[model samples]
Target: MRYVREFKGFAGIRLESDDIGTADDPSIILLHGFGQTRKIWEDVAVGLEQAGRHVINVDLRGHGGSDWPSDARYDFDAYVEDLRAVLGQMRTRPVVVAAMHSGWIATAALAEDAATLASGLILVDPQSESGAQSVRACAEELSASVGQGLAKPDYDERLLDIFDVDGSGARLLDSAPHINIPVLVVRGALGSGHRAENSTGYADAFPNAEAINVDGGGLLVNAERTEAFNGLLIDFLERKQPRFIPEYRSGSDARTLRDAMGCFATGITIITAHDADGKPIGLTANSFTSVSLDPPLLLVCIANNAGSAETLRSAQSFAVNVLQIGQQPVSNLFAGKGEDRFAGTRWEVGEYGAPILPSSLGIFECTRNALHEAGDHFLLVGKVEKASFEPRRDPLLYFRGKYRRLHFT
Candidate 1:
């Protein structure tokens, strides 16, 4: 069964979508590229519904049945906010599938809160980084096609002049690492002209992403290779956005158990102290908690084989620096190998002689209270001698093995 559905988009604008399949099933939202309407997803929607998924094929602002804003606001941010509004209104998080230029909107919309918005993402023939000249060329081609009656005037022509692509590519690149959900990038012949290195870099930016090349498929892979594209889509959905929940019993693979543990979000921290050689050493850790308030006790678990584990164990004092949103690069530097972590960071000695990252959201200077050996790791408990926190800063969070920011309602 299929019917038309209306959604309240950015600024309460009415956006239209083709609602297919039963609502009980897993859901998917399909977004088309510029100069196209939701009608382009007709065949794909039917295929997804038959495969036990609900589908919402959307018409962006100024296209198809959706409201074309009288304000003529067709900027990139408008499109991004529209998608986020649609996701917020959905009963369940759906896997978003976008083609060509729409991929930029989908990625930007989900970048900040991917785990909360959508379960997965699929990009079809996404551009690496389209410049102003490339966009103008595309507009000229679209106009020529429309003049020759090769395309229908289904969208507003004013969008060509108003839709801004400036700085969008760089923003997309910076947003990639934050979109931690499963992403499938399907490259077709349409983007063959894009530099291979840039294309690879774009796809690799996502922490959890896969890419496939559809050779010989024309500009529009969905239209030219419908069957093949549908096959890949179904397969990714089954694996990443499965209908059933995953369960892990004891004694299963350690990886599965680790994944289960990753579900619990924790604040990121850097355990810092000076080794016997009077050199500052630190490593990123999330296994930290305050054990007692009466005695001001806290504990951090470190892998036994870690380079800093021995030094930290013998040290009389150490500092736990709770990171903030601006210190993600610092966290990476401490976690990474073969880098002078202190050389790249700003720091000062705490009252307890421990290296404290001054800009951290919170700092706990502690004296070594106790140490115990846990399986594969050592528990380093400390008696907090002093503590300081920045009340105005937000914490950096970690969840499901990915970095996340605190999302405010």
Candidate 2:
């Protein structure tokens, strides 16, 4: 099912949207390029809906059924603000799918608060960081290709004003590091205006991002190769595993179940404690999650055969250090069998007598609360005694058998 709705956008402009699929499904917000409307996403939205996703195709201000403000305040900031307003209205955080000029707006928005606003990002044929001259040339070409009957008479002219203004492209470059969400950059193999350098640049800026080119596709890659685009989009979503769906069943293969569980991304942590001999012992683990808040409880599973298993089992207290993006080497160090893991690692003794890694994204000092036998692993539950985190640091992530960094939305 699909329906049209209006949203209050930036500067009092009314943005129109086509809402599709069931409200209970995972949400995906699609933004079209300049001089285009929400209708451009019709085919893509249909495919997404079929895959059990709720899709919202939005028309930016000054285009399609959206209000064309007489004030003529169409700039990069204005576009970003409009998108922010639309996201604010969604019931859940959505995976933003943006193309060309709209991709610029999405980048700026994600740079501001990626952790809170978006779950993932898909940028198609994003606009290049070319100067005003290139933009003006592109505007002229677009105006000629799209006749008066196709777009608003003033769209091209107003769009030129936006491109001519300096700083939007620079801001995008500066804000790239702040985007801490998974991102996919898709470009058309034979596209113009969407430069290869710019596409690769976006991927390089992000902590966790990958780039791909669609064969025989141009600027409108989604429309040109609908099937390929849909497949790519769906695969990325499944790997991200934004919303957990229970699929437990009896008699499932152990390896298969483990593979399925890997779909759920988790932060890497090093569980540290002092053994009976007062030696600092630690092991890398991703099987750590909060269990309770009122009593501040958490748990980490350690393999019974692990070198530190006996130390952890006998320890009265421990610390879980959530690694940062810069700590991949540290995680590797602790995951290995031998070689002094803490020899060069900078750490300090916490109140609970556990070694707390320096510069970790988060540290949870805990008192050993309980231990339970589970298959080949022992579940060690802990009551958190103290917790601290670095707000500016991005977490080290693991998904689908690989280490991942947060890609700014």
Each model's C-alpha lDDT? Answer: 0.85, 0.80
Cα RMSD, model 2: 19.6
lDDT minimum window of 10 residues, candidate 2: 189-198
Model 1: residues with Cα > 4 Å off, grouped in runs: 130-136, 139-151, 189-199, 217-224, 245-409
lDDT per residue (tens digit) for residues 180-202 in model 1: 99999886523333323333555
- Predicted model with the maximum lDDT: 1
Name every residue pair that clashes in candidate 2: 179-408, 180-408, 181-407
